[model samples]
Target: MTDQPIRVLVCDDQELVRTGYVTIFSAQPDMEVVGEAANGLEAVHEATRLRPDAVVMDIRMPLLDGIEATRRLAGPQAADPPKILVVTTFNVDAYVYEAFRAGASGFLLKDAPPAQLVNGVRTVTGGEALLAPAVTRALIGHFAERLRPGDPSRTAREDIVRTLTPRELEVLEHIAQGLSNAEIATALFITPETVKTYVSRILAKLDLRDRVQAVVLAYRIGLAGGAA
Candidate 1:
């Protein structure tokens, strides 16, 4: 990480919530609140103009919702997208899943502690996906049909199997299961550094941006399941 404070943009439909987010982010010595938006349209405009390193996004707003805004700002076709951390009140909702598919890098509950919100900005800025385990399980369970075996995407699955080594495939499975690097190390009887290396290799070989996409790919190919 560089010595520069993270530049952040806060977006929410409620003025009070935006103010709280701005205050919290500004209080952190390593964070700078560059802008705030009361709706998704303004969010896209300000984010495009200011070009913050991270965006704290809300799910519901007039005119446009966070999911579409995230897609416009961070989707596959977006150029040099900023890291988007989606914050919502609903825990296990389809909107959150849509936001993830739209290229959000992290998810957090609105009731989460201020520290978690701060860390979420840092995590996304550092190029890591921050999904809570419970949320992951819920999403996987809700979307299992898209990930079930024999979904006529056999060629993609075959390509993944051919691209990754046996060990790398195992590491990918653990990642899909929501295991952290340290937890994966313990489970695989390897060092944490080794797990990190494997994760990097997986991302590079698959051309995925981060662990979130990796997990999605693993599930899509039937390499991982929605098991608790």
Candidate 2:
């Protein structure tokens, strides 16, 4: 890891929640609060200027919404998007799904324990998607709908997936199912190092940005329906 502490931008409409995040991040020796935004539009502007290592985004705000802001800051069109970790008070699957589709790296509940909040920023900034055990099942369940055979992107996605080897494809399936390297190794009777190697190879071969995109791709091509 870099010697510099992770820089973070905290965005929320609620004054208390925003302050709480700033406090939590400030207390971490490995993290620093670089900026704060009270609304989504401000979030985009501040994030653009501050270029923080990670963004703690809240879903609902006036002027713009967190999902749209996340899209603007981290969307496929962004030249160099920062890692974004969306924090929501409600367990709305649609919002969570939209956040991911818009390019957020991860998400957690506003009521998540302090340790979870701290670790989430670190996890996302370190380039891992931070879907908790509970978030994974719910989020992936919503993610699966993007593959419903009738979606327009399915054909192209299917063609793109043809690049993977059989072994890489197996690894991709486990990733989409939210299995960690160790868990995948256990399930496949291989070493975690081997699983990590396969994961890297799969990402390189598929031209994926990270495991999150890999999961989306797996679901889009119908590889996740029963592949898990």
Best by TM-score: 1
Where is the poorest 10-residue window by lDDT in model 1? 144-153
All candidates' lDDT scores? 0.85, 0.83
- Please count the clashing residue pairs in each candidate, in the order shown: 0, 0
Per-model TM-score, in order, reads 0.93, 0.91
Candidate 2: Cα lDDT at 39 = 95
Writing each residue's lDDT as its tens digit, candidate 1 over 132-211 gives: 66666665677766556664556778899999999999999888877778888999999999988999999999998888
Candidate 2 local lDDT, 1-228, one digit each (tens) = 989999999999889988888998899899989999999999999999999999999998899999999999988899899999988855465687778778888888878999999988888887677468456766687657655644555675566567777778788888888887888899999999999899888778877767777877677667776422
lDDT value, residue 50 of candidate 2? 93
| Runs of candidate 2 exceeding 4 Å displacement | 142-146, 151-154, 157-161, 226-228
